[model samples]
Target: MSPNSTDAMKTNLGEAGAHLKNAATDAGSAIKNAAHVAGDELRMGRSAVKADLADSALAGIAALEEGGGAAREQMDQLMDKGRDLIDSAADLIRERPIASFGAAFAAGWIIAKLARSGDR
Candidate 1:
C-alpha cells in the first residue's frame, strides 16, 4: 500500500476508537444517573409508607379511646340502675314485714321439697 493511504487509514482508525470511548463514557454516566434517581424514589416511597402507617395507628388509638369511654359510661348507668332496684326491694320489705316473712317461709319449704325430689 502507498504511504499516504496507510497514514490516512491510521487516522481513521484512531478517530473511530475515540468516538467509541466517548459513547461508552456517556452510557456509563447515564446508567449511574438512573441508579441515583431510582434510589431517591425508593427512599421517598418508604417515607410515604411510614407516614401512612403512623396515621392509621393514631386513628385506631383514638377509636379505642372513644369506645372505652362509652363502655365506662354504660357501666356507670348499670350500677345506678342496680342501686335503684335494691332500694325498691328494701322499701317493699320494710312495708310488709309479717307478710314477707310468711311468704319467704313458704318459698323455702317449696324449694326444699323440690330439691329433695331431684336428689332422689
Candidate 2:
C-alpha cells in the first residue's frame, strides 16, 4: 500500500476508536445517574413511612393520656364516696353507744371483706 493511503487509514481507525470510547463513557455516566436517582427515590419512600409511623405513635399516646385522665377522675369520685360513708358511720357511733357499737362492728367486718376482695 502507498504510505499516504496507509497513514490516512490509520488516522480514520484511530478516530473511530475514540468515538467508541466516548460513547461507552457516556453510557456509563447515564447508568450511574439512573442508579443515583433510584437510590434517592428509595430513601424518600423510607422517610415517608417513618414519618407516618411517628404520627401514628403520637396519636396512640394522646388516646392513652385521655383515658388516664378519665380513670383518675373516676378514682377520685370513689375515694370521696368512701370517705363520706366512713364519716357518716363515725357520726352515728358518736350519737348512740350500744347501737353505735353494733353498727361499728358491722362496718369493720364489711371493710375487712372489701380489703380481702381487693387482694384477690
Candidate 3:
C-alpha cells in the first residue's frame, strides 16, 4: 500500500476503536442503571409481600377468635342443660324420698348379688 492509504487506514481503525470503547462504556452504565432499578422494585415488592402476610395473619386470628367465642357459648349452653337435669333429679328425689330410698336399697342388693356371682 502507499503511505497515504496506510495512514488513512490507521486513522480509520483508531476511530473505530474509540467508537467501540464508547459503546462498551455506555452499555456498562446502562447495565448498572438497570440493576439499581431492579433493586428498588424488589425492595418495594418485599414490603408488599410482608403487608399481605400481615393482613392474612390478622384475618386468621379473627377467625380463630370467632370460633373460640362460638365454642364458649356452646359450652355455656351445655352447662345450663346439665344444671337443669340436676335440678329435675333433685326435685324428683325430694318429692319421693321413701320411694327413692327403697329403690336405692334394691339396686344395691342386686349389684352385690351380681358382683358375688361374678367372683364365684
- Model 1 lDDT on a 0 to 1 scale: 0.97
Q: Pairing residues by index, what is the TM-score of model 2?
A: 0.46
lDDT score for residue 23 of model 2: 99
Tens-digit per-residue lDDT, 1-120, candidate 1: 567988999999999999999999999999999999999999999999999999999999999999999999999999999999999988888999898899899999999999999999
TM-score versus the correct structure, for each prediction? 0.63, 0.46, 0.68
Clashes of each: 0, 0, 0
lDDT of 2 at 80: 100
Tens-digit per-residue lDDT, 1-120, candidate 3: 567988999999999999999999999999999999999999999999999999999999999999999999999999999999999988988999999899899999999999999998
> What number of backbone clashes does candidate 1 have, counting pairs of residues 3 or more apart or in separate chains?
0
Models ranked on lDDT: 3, 1, 2
Better of 2 and 3 by TM-score: 3
State the weakest 10-residue window (summed lDDT) of model 2. 1-10
Position 27, candidate 3: lDDT: 100
- Write one digit per residue (lDDT tens) for candidate 2, span 4-29: 98899999999999999999999999
TM-score of 3: 0.68
